[model samples]
Target: MKRAAELELALAPRAEGVTLQRWLCGELRAAILAGRLAPGCRLPSTRDFARQQAISRGTVVAVYDQLIAEGYLSGATGSGTTVAAALPIAAAGTAQPRTSAAPGIARAAAADTAGTDDAATKRPRLSRQGQLLANSPFLSREGMVLGRPFSPNQPDLGAFPHALWQRLTHQQGRGLRPDDMGYGDGAGHQPLRRAIAEHLRYSQRIDCHAGQVMILSSAQQALDLCARLLLDPGDTALVEDPGYPGAARLFELGGARVQGVPVDRLGLCTDALPTAEEARLAYVTAAHQSPLGGTLPLERRLALLAWAEAGRRIIIEDDYDGEYRFDGAPLPALKSLDRHDRVIYLGTFSKLLFPALRLAYAVVPEWLAEPFASAISLTVRHAPILPQAVLAAFIGEGHFARHLRQMRRLYGERAACFQHECATQLDGLLTVLPITTGLDATALLPRGSDDRAVAAALGAWGVEARPISFYGMGQPAPPGLVMGFSACNEAAIRRGVATMAPVLESFNAAAAGNRGQAVAGV
Candidate 1:
């Protein structure tokens, strides 16, 4: 049997602020859990320990009684005290002294850390879908905080009506009903939905009612819901070859087999539509094709709708930056031509108002309305009601329309500035495509020059641009840089293009040298 003096010598120093009884109980428990005090080992008698510590015997007895009750030890009138043969719980592994800067904890801590890695390895791995989503571009945390020069798809944050928006938000908050603060209608605020429907009718010429619209946290979330609700593993989904990578990644994460349909200067090649029997759905940015900036011609729009209707397939039309088109009149949305209700029109305030709003809407067919609402409830509960209410007021009061007009003028001038600077500084080095619509301008690199390397080089010099190859989805896309003008002012656009001139020249020169080497080898 271990003596009271020997046990006391092994105990760690007690901490401050803990009761004496707790300190003793904790040290004993730690010792037992750490396996330093072997199972069934005899313990010192309470009376003896009390004498050793110069405390009342009652305190020692109380500690012993509590530990025995917790199944850490066993005691009876004649049994003397002993550690339990069977513990009720797994070893706590290691522990710190109760609220004290106690010595001797280092040994126990070492024991704890030794098992940390082993314990982690024993845990289950991420599911296949989870692993795919984890590695997908949609979930990437890079380039999310955009405001860097020439970043694509970002709106002019500086030109947004912050004061007016704040006023509307404050008004809505003050006037909110008690019900407004609770979980909102899963379909979203009725007034906001109505406002959106009316806005679409006027701007995009889409014939939708408030009942068909469901507000969501973002266009991405809307697509996620669509994927979960409509797609099963191995379903064939078609997206533009040089299209939005986020959409393709989302469908892939949902276990859909995503195929890239080639995009030409006029957008998705209607003649190249995969047979109706082949694809289940197609996602398109018809108002302005993403990254490439092509507007789908009316004939192709009709052809796409005909194919979807004939196949009973779905078409997701993302009218992301339709309001900012500078070329002629903005074309009617693809949904406006959907005679068979196959098109789901997706729109977002993130691009129009600001990204932080995180508000977007989906106008689905009547058949999907209820199911989509139910899905929204399961996925996000509902988009916050207060922002919805404020947006409703903003649109209803004509502020949203006014703001859109202001942005159109502002972005138009910036786009012109961007074009002029590129023509002046980069005429020989790069081909600057016409910016007919959308926030970004796509400039093609010389053939065989690596756009990705150029993009990386630009980042080092404090400018940002997405290489077109990133959106190519393993297919061949024209190598280029997508430089956004919407987020930058005229002066910033000039400076960005000026900075880009030398970088592109260097890459072009390098490509020429590489070509010369190839010819010499031949």
Candidate 2:
């Protein structure tokens, strides 16, 4: 028997929201199951473990009692404690116990659910739609190293006015009404809805009132609610190729057939929009095409509206990063062109304020407002009210506008620096596309060059460049890197570009050599 002093048992620091006893039990159980604690191995006294871990002896005793009840450990008044000799997990690498005298081992095993049959422990089956959502790329953490240089669609979190936001938060907390402490309205705080309505009207010529706005957790939530409310299984939903994967995933989650329409320099090609017979809905990033930063042209916008009107179809216009257009006067949102009231416009504070805020707004037609809000209520109730109130105050007091102006200028400078550095450093390797609006920009790789491979190579070097191919659902777009400069400062952008240059050059050279070899073989 190993001495208690030689056991070297330790507990990991407890995680938030978990009790000390539960944490200790989980760690000890893991040790037993992984064969780290052999069968018949004596455990330290609860008093000794409590002293070593700086936890209460009662908690350690409780954990041991619980583990014993679950058949993981065997203990008696005088026998101290030992790992269960007859644990069923022995076949899975845990050693069989050398001693069978441990008290209540058999009785505990019979009582414990852990000894249940394999069929009882199998994972629950998912529905077909649930399977698609489960395997979604949107949930993938690949290339999602936050604060890394050129991480696509990421805003400059370092530049957010944290002090100002905290001040507003504190003010809201102080002024909260008793009603504010309760579950909030499904449509969100009235003041925030009004503020958003006013801001949209003034900035984007969107004709809306507070009644038409529904605030939810994030743009994804808003889209999910839209999918739940609007799409039926086997129905067709049109999404742009090389567009937001999250939206497509949401629509697919509702069992809708997500058909990707092709996009070009001017955004989604209106000429290619199929007749809206089976198509129930269309989603577009009209302000600036996602992955490829091109504003939808007025001609295409009018044509799209015409298409929706002709078929009584719903159009979801995601103006996700429309706030920072550096080129010309901002175009009115596709929502503003909805004479037929078929457009549901979505906007997010995640891009504008910060991602962690997790607040976004949706402007639906009068007919759909109640249902939409009800769906949100039935789903998530609503976004936290205090943050909603604070954002309302932020917009009403002019801080939102001030911040927008500051970010636009800062991001513009970063964009320019990024493009210049790309031109100087990656001249022969790739071409950085012209940036007009949005946080990220696309840089097309040399024709036939492997964008995914290049992106992987760059990721290994600490640069997070998402390949554009990851966004496509249909015909592939040009091999390109969707790199963001907004999250990275000018120096980091320059450094990122410098790092990418040599790697791209080597790949390009190899590709050329491979082409020569192919031609020689032919």
TM-score of each candidate structure, all chains considered together:
0.81, 0.82
Tens digit per residue, CA lDDT, model 1, 164-238: 889998999999888777777899999999999998898889899999999998999998888888888889999
* lDDT for each residue of candidate 2 in 428-456, tens digit (9 for 90 to 100): 78888889888998899989988889999
Candidate 1 achieves a global lDDT of 0.84
Which RMSD does model 1 reach against the true structure?
Answer: 6.0
lDDT of each: 0.84, 0.85
